[model samples]
Target: MVYIAEENRYSDMPYRRCGNSGLKLPAISLGLWQNFGANKPLQDSRDMLLRAFDLGITHFDLANNYGPPAGSAEETFGSVYRSDLSPYRDELLISTKAGYYMFPGPYGEWGSRKYLLSSLDRSLNRMGLDYVDIFYHHRPDPDTPLEETMGALDQAVRSGKALYAGLSNYGPEDTLRAYDILKSLGTPMVIHQPSYSMINRWIENGLHDVLREQGVGSIAFCPLGRGQLTGKYIDKIEAESKSGNSSMKPEAIEPARIAAFRKLEDIAKRRGQSLAQLALAWTLREGGVTSALIGASRVSQIEENVKCLEQGPLSEEELREIDSVSAVIKDIPW
Candidate 1:
């Protein structure tokens, strides 16, 4: 069956500028991490992509090690792209990253120029892409020289393999250093992907201020605290709950965490937003954040989360209340 995107999709959502760059991403982008892996049904993944595009999600994020078996998510995305999204290629913002355990051997992972470029080439092949909109050095490498990694990013842009370069999961000090190197190379780092949510707020420590001042945009992933803020486990984990394989397992949701969650739920109700919606809205409140990178296995989850657009930059009172719950929710077990 042929999939046709909605012509009015552009009006379904809003776009915000990514840093000072010319690129603008949807307020909520889709991430191909867990549910899009080979372990899941291809048709379900395809349907999610189509519905996301129809709802104006222009950016789709991927990483080389996203699947149970690394690289399978990209392979799945490639299959769907060839069958459906190829026609709307010009309207999409596709990004893929390296610097994680992608394959075997020493060269399989890390920030070395050899690994980053080769991994990107393989990524392009897997996705059948001429070039990704932005290519990223997925994380900071302690052993690899920052210059070598940044140079590979610059080389990628100079070679026309990627339009812009980015960094993910990097801390404030490292981001500053990398930005200086990339700027000197004349290929500025435009964005950062960070783990952020109501419960997990490390970016608030300093990264948010740095990104805002440096004109680098941030896309926050896992804004729901892996279902803690979703009201899913507020009462009890459901029979069909994904808690078994979830990063936030049942045992990790201790009584202390639930007490804090209950408070947040009450606050969200007063704000006229669900716990999940409030979590998403809170991440977007900061001017430095470009988008909320959300993952969903089903279409209904996407539909429900998109309503975050209708929510808010929570009030000062609500914000204070949320801060009170922060301590109880941090350092969740992996």
Candidate 2:
């Protein structure tokens, strides 16, 4: 069948500006961090990508080391893009990052200029893109001078290999420093990707305030807490087969946390939403990230998650109740 997108795909989903930049990403973006690798069927990856676009998810986030084999997710996305999304290139906001362990040896990872630029080239090559919309330093390199790393990102935008610069997994202090460096280099830092969810509120401590002050937009990953907040664990706790490599560990699913998840599920029911939807809605509430990045194993999961926007933002009372329930839940020591 031909893959013509739905005409009304842009009708319902809202697009939020990325920091103070001219770019605006769909409030709900799809992430290729998992399930889009060579290990998964290419057809499944294609289906989810097309369906997410059909639902107005214009932004697809990726990284150089996303796949199990490393670089396979970008290949999968490249295949799908060439086959179905080629014509809509101008309408998409594709972003990829570096800074994690990718290949072996000295230049394989970290925020060094050599690794960052080289990794960006590989990412662009794997995705079959001439340039990415946003290029991010996946994490702060403790050894690499901040100037050298930020310089590479600035150079990426200057050379037309990336339209904007971004940072991920950087703490509040480092983010401010990176922002200053990018700004001085004449390229405005646009967005920051951080891990945030109802269960993990680390960003609330200071990251949000820094982002607001610096005018950088934020997109939160793991807003579902690695699927723990999906409510499926309420009835039964299954061990995460992937363990450290991928999914959350079974130990994180303690009995008390499951009970708390049940309380959240009850709240979701009262709000006329599924647990996943409630988690996403809460992640995107006022003063939250600019977009909530979601991963989907099935097309139906994407559909269900996108509907999180339809029920609207969580109310003050709902927020309080959610906070109370999740307050006791601690972040897994990964």
The lDDT leader among the candidates is: 2
Best by the TM-score measure: 2
Question: What lDDT tens digits, residue by residue, belong to model 1 across residues 67-134?
Answer: 75789999999999999999999999999999989888999998999999999999999999999999
lDDT measured at residue 227 in model 1 versus the true structure, 0 to 100: 67
Q: What is the C-alpha RMSD of each candidate to the true structure, in Å?
A: 3.3, 3.5
Error of 1 at 136 (Å): 0.8
lDDT assessment of candidate 2: 0.90
Candidate lDDT values, in order = 0.87, 0.90
